[model samples]
Target: MNLQRTQTAQAPPAPRPGPVLAALAAAQFTVMLATSIVNVAIPQIRAGVGLSEGGTTWVVNAYGLAFGALLLAGGRAGDLLGRRRVLIAGLGLFAAASLGAGLAVSPETLIAARAAQGLGAATIAPAALALTMDLFPSGPRRGRALGVWGAVSAGGGAGGVLLGGALTQAWGWPWIFHSVAFGSVLVLVAVAALVPPSAGRAAGKFDLLGTATVTVALTCLVWGLTTARGTGWTDARVLGALLGAAVLLGAFVVIELRRPNALLPPQLFTTGRVAAGNLLMALLGSVWIGLFFFLPLYQQQVLGMGPLTTGVGQLPLAAANIIGASLAPRVSRRIGATATVSAALLTTAAGLLWLSRISADGSYLGQVLGPTALIGLGLSFAFFQLTALAVDGVPPQDTGLAGGLVNTTRQVGGAIGLAALATLAGSVTAHASTHRTHLEALTAGYRTAFMVCAATMAVAALLAVPLTRRKGRADGSRTPTAADPTTLPRQGRATRRTPAA
Candidate 1:
């Protein structure tokens, strides 16, 4: 009886999917929230810190640049070192960076802090996602979990504007950073308690050369795109940065192909629709990121709304996003993943076309809310479907790599799209300003951007028809592989141990 009691007591408890999902979703939410929260607060931050226009731009760009550049390295580290350990370390660093940003009184300090926060975010995002994959085997359960993840992520992007406006109106801009800091701490504690430790999958030398070349290349690309929004694309510095990025990327590709232990294995792309999925993800992100940027500007600048009102105006979009994400798995099951994604993209394109009809004297209800709601719904559906496709059939050891690759594609695509769209809008506004009123000209520019975005989405929808059509369940379901927790050796326990660092 004593032996029986001891055996039962030593057995591990069954995993609780709810808390794990909540914690991971919360971490992603905080990362995306930080990306946009600062946008509404930019004017306030500038006034408080005596920032120049250029400095203010950096304050926004710094986080994205660092986050986009180091994602691959961070994801690889999580796979080789340990996902749980990397997550905790990332949360700690993110908390500290947020606190520093909150306390910063100088432009330099704030920018630096923001960059550090990006680094922490880079570490946290892939590790959190990889852990989610570990917890849920690929099937209906994983699909549902990813649906929640998609909902919170899209919500976070829109919610940041609302939360930032409310916080800035009530207390100040500093509280935005403080709120992130507090949230990170809470997530850190929850993850530490709820998540089981897993060992590193590989025991090999780190891919230092590939890491360096790719990181610098990504940094240059992001920097160039960001600069193109302020200084024209023809500027010398922008051209130089673009050239440098191109050269470095070639070197990185060569290194990856030759190295036995590549940071990004070439075979990963050959695995079940990964390449096509990432390509579609890039297209989706291009419009999704730029839509958020121009929509807020149209509300505040042309419609003459206050920060808080503009933020509140986004409620319809957020609601639609949640609803769409909730329905994505079911929709995919019913209609099929490829069909769902293609239809969603077409839906988004139609909404953008409607938005292109916005007038100088447009009302929020007619010109903004309806179209934005449609966009929110469609984009969420596409995002959820594409994310699942991107990671499908990935190997057990490379789960982190798959997660990182998908995210990197999205961010890079967003950066490029935002820069191009912003430039096109600015030029249109400038040209129209010569022949029209300021408000009319601004509206015209915004309208032009919407038209372009719609065209892009339409093209993406067409591309999706051919790209992801393969023999599988119409729902895109697959047999569980070694990547699934149930199929993993030692029941998903790590093969080797190492410090997170």
Candidate 2:
């Protein structure tokens, strides 16, 4: 008798997306809606909850603090644990937290619940992103999926600006949180029924020390900056917190560099794509945040519209953005990334420049509509491309870190932008000679802020130029074969040099 040997192998089946996508999109929209929806309800919440200035402001800040500070940790958890599992847990927690917040009778309770909601957001966002990548194998399919997803992420502020007013005026402050809570329940139901569980990271340890240090640093820095708004920049408390945060961040950098399993590996910065993407994200985030803060005042206080009307008025911007963000991929494929990104930034700058020309008598159609709509259009262009660039070329092993970095860019950028713009606007208002002059002065301040944003974003567009090649590159632009498991870690390491495509 002769012995026969046979060997057979089959490549794992290709991933297919289930109904989870629709549910995930809903969840993302709700999370983003939290930012804009709450702005219109601030005054009501303040009166109802007995919030002092800082305390009322903290209602918003608490959510941001938790989400921004803990995003890396949450993402790491999703990578190590199953993403579906994390998504479920996050949605459940978010619903509960939102319920608690909606029913809150006190500022303290509201702030606490808001923070919990943010933590939940941190969990859901990364898991959702990871799931999207896992589901789509890239190319045109992923691009379209990403275009829609990017709209949810990037165009959120405009939606918030419009929806917040309507919800707040029609339903009340609690309705904002209540709506999210209810929507979250629906998302959970959809996710549980439709999504398939995927394998988590094979073997990696969460960088607890690195996460802790970074968390403390971000929390401290954001806290100090926010406080510095009312208090002088030189206040002892602000100074101490800022200095402490700096030191902690320094320590964090040192710790991560040495650690075997750093949360955000230092080597990742070697990829130019990552660097450029994050930079642009931060700049655009700042502009987006500042827009919400000032526009309501501009429309309501300056233009003499009711809250509901103001919200309704912003619908044009939101509507335009939705259209623009959805079509961004088509634009990119035809024009190439550099031209698209630069055009967006320049358009945004021009819009702001137009806003600079606003007089006290400026009409919504004549002035506000043009500028805000352009802002919406420009932002969609920048945001979609920047998002594509951020996660581009990232190695599978570093997906968690890369996703976390993108979230971090947006959060930190918004924090910094809001702080800088609000402070400048306040200073300008103080210097105005008359009430009319004050609105004009504030508008003047906004003009300057917009110019700065435009300039910064232009530089950001330049950074993308080197990254944007005629054809998609490995890291900066997602292609069908870009997700090879073996190339993942290298993507992380080279992230800083990759630029964007």
Candidate of highest lDDT: 1
Backbone steric clashes in candidate 1, count:
1
Candidate 2 per-residue lDDT over residues 1-501, each given as its tens digit: 123222223434443364567777777777777767777666677888899865755776788778878888887888888788988999999999999999999878999999999999888887788777777654656666677777787567767767677877887878888988988899899888777776557368988889889888988888887788788688999999999999999999899889988888777766546676777778777777667766776777677776688888877778777888777878876665667777887777777667666666677778788888887788777777776667776766566567767777787778767776666666566566365576677666655666666666667666656754334456656432221222333455566676672
Per residue, candidate 1 scores C-alpha lDDT tens digits across 273-392 of 788889988887778777877777788878987678878988898999899998987777666667888999999999999999999998998789889899889888887878788887
How high is each candidate's TM-score?
A: 0.91, 0.87
The reply for model 1, stretches above 4 Å from the true place, is 1-5, 471-501
Considering summed lDDT, which 10 consecutive residues are worst modelled in model 1?
A: 482-491
